[model samples]
Target chain A: MGRRIAQIICFAFGALLFALYFSQHPTARSLNTAVMIDYWQIIFAITLLVGVISFVRINLSNIRRGDNRPYRIISLVGLAVMPILAIIWGIKGNSPFMWMFEYVQVPMQSTVFALLAFFVASASFRGFRARSAPAAVLLTAALLTLTSRSSLEGIVPQFITEAADWVRGNPSMAARRAILIGIGLGSLTTSLRVILGIERTWLGSDK
Target chain B: MDWGVIIAGLLTLAIFSFLYRDNPAYKMAESLLIGVSIGYFLVITWTNTLMDLLFVPLTQDAKWPLIIPLALGVMMFGRFHKRTAPLSRIPIAVLIGSGAGVAIPAMLEARTLRQISATVGPLVTESGLPDISLIAVLVGVLTTLVYFYFSREHKGALGGAAKVGTYFLMSFFGTTFGYTVMSRMSTLIGRVEFLLSDFLRLTQ
Candidate 1:
């Protein structure tokens, strides 16, 4: 009875919300969803506690085992302190949460991304070599767009920019539309799998 | 010069250290990032999807109508248990039925018809100087489609078409690579700005 109840609730709600999302009504569909999403944002906020607990357990155990003492200590402290300060002071305005997010997390994520630029340069120099006929045409189109986008327009003439406009507007847009159609079909299929319970693997390891 | 900048710089070094050797610092940062993300999302889904989709609607809107589906979702959880789990079938079947209903039309329309329609356009172009764009599209559609045609040896007419298709592929790759490079460069620029403006007592 309980199990049946859960499944019914999941489907009915999923369907209703899905329909509501598509509907024109601002209140019955959109606003209700926005409110629910806001309420559910609590879970991620609360996950900070779960993260700290798990980190402390793992790092403390690592230290006790004399394995990775120094790095473990760093994780242990960072996990413990930042959230406590943020929670006590509140996250908005001039709080520790806002400070740590802006300074630390934001920079780290950005720096990691910055490093990806080096990878792209290396890949372009090495991986983009045309071993076939079709590859050559693709390379030509790619080079046009790349030069157009980059700061190289000052050195290269205006003709390249015109060619890029032709490629992007007509051929590329057509391909993109075709790809979007495929993606839409793919997503619809996946949603169906989940709804039918054919894709219950998301429920986790058991069934 | 500031302590905060020093630490961030070190963190950068620690992370980038993987280029040479597998350092403990890099591993720690990577693992923490993964663990935190996973834990965070699990909590998020429980609240966002489960609570909102399964709980609130049943409570606030329809009462008994929700009971059957809720029972199905519960049966899903039963897979975790050893017995009585066969009860999961009723919900699972209904889900499959509904899924097929929703997907069949969408897949047929979007994937089959619309996709084909997008490829189907005039052989000529408005600019019309040999219509390289049209030629490119025609060749791309023919050869790339032929690249899949696999029944015959790719030597004569089809082989030549597929050969031009290679140029199409290369240009596609090159564009993707360039965009990726620009995106990364922007990230690097942002980080540098943060370090310069926020951490250091320097330029705003």
Candidate 2:
């Protein structure tokens, strides 16, 4: 019964918002803005708390099980410390909170992504075996692209760069657009299914 | 001179150390990253969204309508408890439903219609010359679409066309991969520069 009501509520809100997009009524516009801006913001904030709770729960379990307890403790401590510091000291641009963010979080995130550089280079060399015609074409395109973008652009002839541009603009873009079209249509179908309650996967099997 | 630069350099080295092999430093840095990111988001959400948007409006402006979302938000925490887990589904459903509804129209307009319109243009440029690149794009798009059309058996001319489409798709993927590598390399360069210039004072 509860799940049924939840699904109904979900359908109603979705339909209402969908209708609002098409409608120009003043009341609907105000409600739409309020729901999206004010209401959604709060809801999203509450969702973040849910994430923090889950993190704590899992890390605590790990610690209790004696599985890398020290690292788990470090994680929990790091998690707990920043928010406490922020709330107590505030997170202005020059505050300790922002300092920790700029130093620790910023570098860590960037370095994490940066680590992909070595992996990509190694992986491409290992993976780009030209066993087939399509594979050969792919390898050629990749090489041309890298060379066109690198310092070798000056060393390589201008015509090669033009060819690289043509390849990127034509074939690459067409494939990308085809994929995008597929994704758009698929999303529309899935959204309609959810709105009409045809998709019940969101409703857990607990009931 | 600055502590921030020192800490950042150390963290960068810690993460890069994973290139050698997974070690304790990498593990610690990874954990710290997750913890700090979540913590940062938590505080930002509390101050920026909760205090500013919800609490202030409800208390000061007396926006009674805000209570509806507040109640729903509190109910989201019910998932942790066994009996109320079903109740939590309500908010999750509304979130998913509304998200899908919003995404559907936006994606259709942006991704599908606009892309198709862009793809459909004259084969010749204003200079009255045959636009070779445009022709290539049109042919690539059609063949790629045909390749994706799996309702019918791919044989004869269709099979040949699909083979051509496979090459186009592979070339596209390759270029995309190269571009991604370039982006990642730029980030790595930035970190290396920071270490040399800011932390080690090796270069100005």
Candidate 3:
């Protein structure tokens, strides 16, 4: 009974929204905007809070089990501190919340992203071996792109940049376009399946 | 003293410490990052999303239709318990269904139709010169699509086209990697600049 209701709601909303896309009426447009913007955001926000609760519960259990207790405690502290700070100081300019975001969160986020450079370089060193024709093409293209983009761009011959630009414009663009087309078709099919109730995987049960 | 810069620099170093070896500092920094990010998002969602969108409009403007989504959002909390878990499915279904519905037309127009139109442009330029790049792109697209078509066995003409497609795919991957590395390197340089100029006061 519960599953049937859920499926009905899913099909109803999905079919309604999909049908709404084709309409030029003002009411349809407003309905689409309201649901897509307001309703979606509200639901998504609540879902995120649910996720955070789950995360906290898991971490708390881990801490209780003495699984890296100190680090887990520090993590919980960080989690608890942000909301408290926001509540006390608000999230306005010069507020402690903004201060933590600017100083602590942003820096760590960027550093983590930056850290990927080392891993990428190391992976490339091991993986960029040109043992076959396709591998050679990959290596050549990578080198051309890297050299053209690097500080050595001025010192390198003009043809290198031209070749890199050509590769990016032609073959690379084609590959990406093909992949995009494939993705579009796949998404369309999957969406149809979901709306039609053919895809029940999201229901989280076979029964 | 600029405590902001000091704290940021120390945390940045702690993250970078993983390059040497994973230690307590790195673990602590990683855990803190996860926790703080969740908290930050939670606050933003509350203020920017819930309070501004739902509460304000529902109370002041009397936009009663907002209650539908509000009820759905509340239903998401049902997931916390075992018996009430099934109730969460309705909201999840609504989100997924609507999202999928929107995605159908959106993906078709943006990803499929536009890309095909772009790819199938004139092979010859206005000046009457044979556009080698366009020809190459046409071939690349066709061959790449052929490579993805798995129903047919790779033999004869299909094999050759698929082989060429692999080269194009590899070139695409390589170019993407190059760009990714460059972006990461730029971020790394910015961190180094911050450490030297802002934190250490070594540079102008």
Q: i-RMS values of the candidates, in order?
A: 6.4, 1.4, 0.9
TM-score of each prediction: 0.64, 0.95, 0.97
Q: Grade the docking of candidate 2.
A: medium
Chain A TM-score from candidate 2: 0.93
Assess each model's interface with DockQ, reporting 2 decimals per model.
0.21, 0.74, 0.85
For the record, the alpha-carbon RMSD of candidate 1 to the native fold, in angstroms, is 6.6
The candidate maximizing TM-score is: 3
> Compared to the true structure, candidate 3 yields what TM-score?
0.97
lDDT-sorted candidate list, best first: 3, 2, 1
Query: Taking the tens digit of each residue's C-alpha lDDT, what string does model 2 give over A1-207?
Result: 988898888888888888888878999899878877777888889988998999899999999999999889988988998988887788887888999899999999999999999999899879889998899888888888988998789999999899899889889888888888888888889889998889988887984
CA lDDT of every candidate: 0.58, 0.88, 0.93
Residue B28 deviation, candidate 1, in Å?
Answer: 6.2
lDDT of 2 by residue, B14-99 (tens): 99999999999999999999889988889888989998988998999998888988998999999898988887887787787677
Regions of candidate 1 where Cα sits further than 4 Å from its true position: A1-69, B1-3, B17-20, B24-169, B189-204
Per-residue lDDT over A24-104 for candidate 1, one digit per residue giving the tens place of the 0 to 100 score: 776765443442343224323333334445566777889899976776666555555554654477546667655555445
Best DockQ among the predictions, by candidate number: 3
Query: Taking the tens digit of each residue's C-alpha lDDT, what string does model 3 give over A1-207?
Result: 888998998899899999999999999999999989999999999899899889889999999899999999988999999999999999999999999999999999999999999999999889889999999988888888899999989999999999999999999888998999999989999999999999989989633
